[model samples]
Target chain A: MTDATGSEAGTAWRRIADELEAAIGRGDYQEGATLPSSLALAERYGVHRHTVRQAFRHLADRGLVTVSRGRGTQVTAPRFPYRIGRRVSMRTNFGAAGISVAGSMLGAEIVAGEAEACAALRLEEGAPLWQVEALSLAGGIPVSTGVHLLPVARFPEFDRVFVESGSSITAAFKACGIPDYVRLSTRLSARIASEREALLLKIEPGAAVMVSKAVDALPDLTPIHLIDGIFAGERMEMVVEPFGELPSPPAGESGA
Target chain B: MTDATGSEAGTAWRRIADELEAAIGRGDYQEGATLPSSLALAERYGVHRHTVRQAFRHLADRGLVTVSRGRGTQVTAPRFPYRIGRRVSMRTNFGAAGISVAGSMLGAEIVAGEAEACAALRLEEGAPLWQVEALSLAGGIPVSTGVHLLPVARFPEFDRVFVESGSSITAAFKACGIPDYVRLSTRLSARIASEREALLLKIEPGAAVMVSKAVDALPDLTPIHLIDGIFAGERMEMVVEPFGELPSPPAGESGA
Candidate 1:
């Protein structure tokens, strides 16, 4: 679709890919829907078939479409929107969305806290900590791998409770007598997935993974645990909620 | 740098890299500091120099270090911590950190709001909107590029005001009589940088970039604007604040 002025040159393929992406975004192309054939797209755009093929390649590379031999290109399902808020829970969020979710402990160990984890949890370096590795699955597809660290002294039986409670961190916290907790801070970044991460998340090596380093705290803002999660970028998008009252505008700050 | 159980086979290089990363995290290597030489690291880890080189290569790939001949590997400076909260302002955030911040309008145009933008702003399909493209500089380095959209009819001179106010979105909002606004929601994802984005943000092509789609609303929760920003992943990290009182724990929900 051309804008008001017209399409820019040398970006014809990109423009086509963007148009197709927008179409998908608008729900014109639903999951499992087949995209138009290259010949048809070429005719519609008045471009060569190769150009349409290039556009298809672009879409496929973006994880928007999957092309198979003999079958036409099919639009991939959209990522689940997971909200990160004060009372957020992975299980509750996925369940409320009518998605079957499950979590399983991959491994667990007790080790001295690393410097970063120690600072976040307000513990001394080399303090004993429980490192729990877990995987979250949505509809039978692994979506994230999380490494959680907690002060071992505070939660002596954390690993046992986590595994026994069906890998629910909330359950483990409750077992440890922490009835409620809130997200204190979350830092967001991204990088190419490592081989191990890609294997756990079922994505190709070097694929983008959204990394979140988050801290959970008690009602009094006492830090409880630190979690670093590697989420399959194409499988989910993070929705963050900002909490608190809006601040009043500064005087004389408006443009006149 | 081996753990209690010892490093796994075939992952020694990764383990060493992780140890170095943690050391850096602990400030063993400050910004602008050069990491230990590969030969020294190799000897310390009881590994061959090639393994050390591989570790350095991995760190460089992650944008944590830059390796150049003769000068040794240098750690990249840490990015500014940008807080996304009730009153989120790029200029204000960097300014409070004692960093010189500036923004400039790269371009502006009136275009029909795309489906996603329209949905966020609650406008009719194809509604005319002013799209302001801006670049944010912190300490004279380009850190982010933002494309902000507002209903054209509501802010007729938004582009001019924004440009004249030194590219401050707050000033344009004030010009439109919106004294205050709050961040309603933000969605974050990541993707490989496009060539144009790489050039604009001064990052290498194919590098990871953090993408955020945010909605800002009035105090009463009426959506006013939408922004899609591409931030250099290696250059900045997003910090978010949670709003509202902590919810009481659900009865009988904790593990016994």
Candidate 2:
């Protein structure tokens, strides 16, 4: 084990990668700036050329850099924070940040909820839900392809509002007499996007997508929204802030 | 735009990919089963061989299958679930799930708190803190790398219990007469693992790692634990439960 300097410790490639990563993070290599060739990196770090390549490969996989066959690797443009911290609608969240939220209605139809959908929304089996598939754009660039489910009984005007406004579904619910909502739970998974999502997001089908499944509740505690968002992992960041009160001490416990 | 399961979609490769993905998820081909040849898949799906290849590439990128030029693609074995859901200790969470938890103390030393560390633990800048690094294993397989920060002034005998038990930092706190703690907040991010963490977790540097920064408070609201855990993305899963009271309707509006 080594100290924070990360020298004389683990595998040579790893040490090289750490130092290089810190350098990149510290803005030693600005966005779109070409990184050193593997040979040059090897010479500087005193490691095999392949070690540097492996390090670069790692950075490429994390969407931190771009590597070309003949041309040298370059640091990637950093993505803006796609805030997923609050219970706000995706459209409003971006719109509030002055980013235009635009996407065509890929499809809009009433369908029997899938088993996974039923479980997430806490609805009965085969409940009818409006499954609206759409893509979300940030400043006219596709950033995510997703599907949102609303219980048909709860949002009777879903299709109408969806086609016209394409804004916050929760806000639309407020217009329909449900003013507010709360997010219940979320499940996160990373996977290769489906060919459709990839095409919509303008990335390779095998590209990573960050999948989030959330259950939202109406003011009366009724589950109304089960949103399944699939974001181009290369384009977005999901944040979570957990809250809780401190545990109480046993009776007569001293402060010390 | 493509409608649900209809003809005249934008791309044939996407439709083929979706069908294959659903089939695989539904267990049409079990783990270790070889998928049909690209030529055969093209014939069956009425698409070009290149389309099938594209579909397979998507599967491979998600680590769902492995492809050999001559042998075709085979379903990959599913990985174990790396639980990061609850506020429980790493040892307790894995142990209660009947998974063995083991780790080697990589390094431990008393040091002045860094700016970030001080802010996290609510300690004065440059205050003495016990910094410990460890690599954790589950079922004899490395899954996470962690660095812990403990205020030395609060736990005067921190080093002794850490070396003796090596099970959990929470247990160490109990031995120091501080019990009943609550997790205050947890912030998560996806990042490339440092060289040291990559080596410890048996993943390549630059592989996506789930980073969680958490602060723990004592029963009496004294900040105690500031933990930074890096979990191997291939194995980790974080299930977050968000609970809040739903908002009520604004003054007296009946059904619109």
Candidate 3:
């Protein structure tokens, strides 16, 4: 189970993990194959039972294995790359990774702006805006539910575009002459899901999900969109890249 | 739970959640105290029981409440401000937040550099370095455990300073004549815990933790420290700030 140049070392468990990983890679242990129990592996490797458990833990982290108490450890098939590179549309991201995107639009309507939404759009409170709520999916599995706001006066027919076309959000915005946008800021935190969200994401009540609030701006610095996305934490990761310097100032006038 | 402005036009559950949050702020519900059951809240707020449950979910995300099956929704005190400010010592950060630091040094030993460590430290594969493993605690709760590597040749009296001074690693390096260092880079990821780390962090095996690998460098571009820290995900946050601009090309290293 060693690598071609076997220099990696740890206690017995790590060695066993490495060997198991190699066997998985070599197809000796196919995806979904049940691995020997910790007791069995311990007996075979002549190590403590705890040592075998450690080996399984290492494999789990690498996405090579999953353990269920009653079912034991089983190989996990390699998952599609869930990349969070900023250069793609959210829709394109899932599509490129071979995941299906399927979700019913909850609602789309023009409304008087709420205080937070107005501030995010750089408009006065009560200004006209289009708000859209959608459940986003990957591989037909609900991953996030999001609400997006955009100034309706700036983008007339926003609701129609959302309703009639399956185009990317960026495309919809570009059609309104806001050709380019840069993400100005984002805030991330975690929280338990509501029953509705939990049902959508198919997780327990107390399971944590990532809450992301993002603001984007047009090239001329006009605020364009404010989005609140709740992501299933166990199924997702977020990547942030700070350009040239560290600690860019937080966004918004009050920095709230 | 009205907002200060007291305009409520959204869903019933949202307003209920807001009112409950306001009531908490008003000291109507003490921290750790169970809230009225969903039925009770629904009756008081004139909403459905499910709507009250939805309100509780909102409070949970704000970190103000926790809900369990047997234990109803309960108020929680504000979480510790896990400051993620860039470029602060671990001790300094925790100290500023009024948390004490304690450690049980798992081991401190001279180790031959592995290939990965050698590449990171720019040393020969067999070069000697001091590897120190410690379980660090805050508020008397173990929240992080880490391993640090320092070049043994540079800190000639490493063991003596670490043993005698009881100072932080940075201070110990300063005592050995290396007075300044800058963190070069950090890599971040997250994964569920293993049996060993789970025991150390006092969490279940599937609980997530934050993982960071950082390299610190001295003025002459020599590596000073290589640190790998794992923080309890629910208990800590990391802030990073980049400053100024990237270094320009070296005169001696002209490129075509």
In order, the first chain's TM-score in every candidate is 0.77, 0.73, 0.72
Per-prediction DockQ = 0.26, 0.20, 0.10
lDDT of candidate 1 at residue A120, scale 0 to 100: 70
Query: Which of candidates 2 and 3 reaches a greater DockQ?
Result: 2
Candidate 1: Cα lDDT at A95: 87
The number of the candidate with the highest lDDT is 1
What CAPRI class is candidate 1?
Answer: acceptable
- Residues A138-165, candidate 2, lDDT per residue (tens digit)? 8888887667788887777777776656
- Alpha carbon lDDT of residue B92, candidate 2? 67
Q: Per-residue lDDT tens digits of candidate 3, residues A1-256?
A: 1112223335577679867877776777887899999999989998888889878977774456877668799997543333332233566667766766766567776767755567657678789887777777778777778778888777778766754545357767777776677655544544556667788778655455666556666655456887777777656655433321223112111100
Model 1, span A1-256: residue lDDT tens: 1134445433678778888887876778888799999999989999988888878876774457866556788897766878777766788778887988789888777876755567678777779998887899988999989888889889988878887878888888888899888888777777667677788989866567787877898889888888888888767878876653223233212111
Q: Candidate 2: misplaced stretches above 4 Å?
A: A1-86, A91-104, A138-143, A192-208, A232-237, A244-256, B1-4, B8-86, B155-160, B191-199, B202-208, B219-222, B244-256
Worst 10 residues of 2 chain A by lDDT: A247-256
Q: Kindly report which residue pairs in candidate 2 clash with one another.
A: none
- Fnat of candidate 1 is 0.48
Give the TM-score of chain B in candidate 1. 0.76
TM-score of 2: 0.69
The true-versus-predicted C-alpha distance at residue A233 of model 3, in Å, is 3.8
Q: Which parts of model 1 are misplaced by more than 4 Å? A: A1-40, A48-76, A243-256, B1-40, B48-76, B243-256
Q: Comparing chain B with the reference, what is the TM-score for each candidate?
A: 0.76, 0.74, 0.76
Report lDDT per candidate: 0.77, 0.66, 0.65
